[model samples]
Target: MKISILTSLLILLSLAAQTSPVLKIKFDDIESGNIFLINVQKELTDTLSINNGKVTYEAKIAAPTFFYLIVDGYNNTRPLELVLSSQLTEMKFESYKVVGENTVNEAYPNSPIFISDPNNNIAFFEFLSHWKSFYNTIQALSENDSEEQLEKRKNTYHTFLSTNKQIIENNSDQYVSAKMIDFLLNNNLLQFETLQTYYDLLSPKVKESYLGFKIGEKSGKAGQLQPGKPAPEIALVDIQGKKYSLQSLKGKNVILHFWSSSCAPCIKEAPDLLKLQQGNTENLVVINFSLDTDNSKWKKGIERAGIEEMINVCDLQGYNSVTAKSYDVTFIPVYYLIDANGNISLKGTLSQITEKIKEDMP
Candidate 1:
């Protein structure tokens, strides 16, 4: 979809000095769309006029040459094959679905292949309408909201970004997915830590969440994770006063979605979750973890919300919930997506939670 808010900071640091190496690139016009080569350390540079859709260039780069490009509206890793003797690099484009003689076995089988033949390529931009709609809503909402309204706005926007992050985490083999995560994290309007936890869980991209980290006392930060981490053990109480641990729910796709009567935002999300639960979402085990402090009120609120028929529990500690502490739960109305393999996939909103369910369902 787009770079996650968590990875944008890393991208910015990697590009700060660009002393990595000197690489000159030129464009060719022998193809159907506009194209150029770029290094991750910097934006695209040295674009040349292409004749008939092809351009050639003489450039110097240290041994491994890798480049990416956005031609028209689609993004791709333009295979950079170095002709050492000629000091020229050849950039080739392929449709995601095109398979070559040497193509590696991958999950994205129908992913694009670089064919000048239009019949062989599917326009990648068409897949992004859902995202564009979400972003447009965030933009419009932001323009009219006041300071207090921003708190409410932040949660919804956070959830939206987390949904895209889940996609990247769910499909780690797709390298471009990480790029999208990076772009989202860099946006100035979003919270850094909320972005990072979602970013860190995907693939082996990086184990660090640089933006949300704190060197001092670390209680209550949404994204501050201990480095080189395993899943934090979380403990919650069932109605019978029996304790349940987050670690115990391994080998299943778990949804640790939080809601509370004290929180107006949390109360508003319950019905949507009820709808998600009814969908029989595949491989998803939703745990409706309540953050309400008063036990009597908590029981009544569930009946009122109509989520009484699902797997629900509470820590009664409210924000001090034991399992919530382990998972670093600062905000109510937030949800965690744990993949079937037990790795954390996402942490965000009910809508985002629903998106992950719809996406991973068979």
Candidate 2:
């Protein structure tokens, strides 16, 4: 009797497991097509063909899972995104131009278009909208703005940062907090004290998650080489076996260019830097720091690119170079323009540096 009862219980449990929730996604006016769902975390792609403009899938998810809904043969363009297991998430796609578009276009029917669980990702979607609006506002600012205008823009950015921080704090337990925290930390927008407090407020589970760990890594590196901050000292040997230091380039406008031989963009921007240095020979100096472990490749690249006009140096440590760490160098081809007083005046792309030089130096 005991064995029979145990077997009956196992059968019931199996049935219960099979009855896990089904996430139904119905697309209206999806003409003769297959929609694919790309799992964000697992890197798995699953497909569902639209039958009478409806497609249903089983979602046995405990944690919030993100899926990119891409229409097949449309350059893998994601028209809709689903953050699952929040609520009864449903999406409706209509009037899509999917044919003959070679490039992956931004998906339309933009957000607050929630699917699955509403509570899980509503904050995240809202944050995205706020960030987008803020970005557009910044982009609209005039490039030839005066010091007062620049200060105003800076103040506006800080205001947005404060607002975003509050949003993250309010939704500390949600996945959106982890993402926002990571972005803020990496962008050098968050204060160290605030970061510590935010981390403390996060639940133990969130603090231990993958996204949380990434946020922790970025938070540890705040206030490294922010604009208007004094450029940090960097001591490294040039390719020609000569030592170079940041202090040595004082009393001249310096470009602290961090790059690598393998970086295509870095190599491509070599000519532009050459032109900038040649054009402003009286006041400018480009200190090119190569983050290359292979000495031979570094030498060859420099010679081939004809970038020997500037001061080039490498410690042969690649990404682990102490100099790179001091400046918080994550991406190569990063340009930090320093004024005669050794304060970082600008930090951005080659074009941005050129624009700044024209505006300020000229």
Give one digit per residue, the lDDT tens place, for model 2 in 1-362: 25698899999898766634445655555656787888767889878787776777775666666567776765364444555653466555455555444322222333433354554566766666666666666656646557676666677777787777788778887766776666555544454445656776667667766667655543432354556788888776775677766688778888888887766567878998899999999999888888889989998879866898578888888768888787766556778888888898876678878999999888
Clashing pairs in 2: 86-117, 87-116, 87-117, 89-115, 89-116
Residue 13 accuracy (lDDT) in model 1: 81
Task: Give stretches of model 1 more than 4 Å off.
Answer: 1-229, 240-243
Question: Residue 310 in model 2: shift from native, Å?
Answer: 16
TM-scores of the models, in the order given: 0.39, 0.54
TM-score of model number 1: 0.39
Which numbered prediction scores highest in lDDT against the true structure? 2
- For residues 1-362, what per-residue lDDT tens digits would candidate 1 score against the true structure? 79997799889887663443232223332244444556544344555444555545444443322244434333343232111211332324333233344432223333322323221112222223335556666656666547566665667666666665556555443333433444443332223244445545544422222212221113222344432235566666666565666567666677777677655556667777777776765555677888778888889888877777777797678767677667665555667777655566766566766776678774
- Total clashing pairs in model 1: 36
Give lDDT: candidate 2, residue 190.
51
TM-score of 2: 0.54
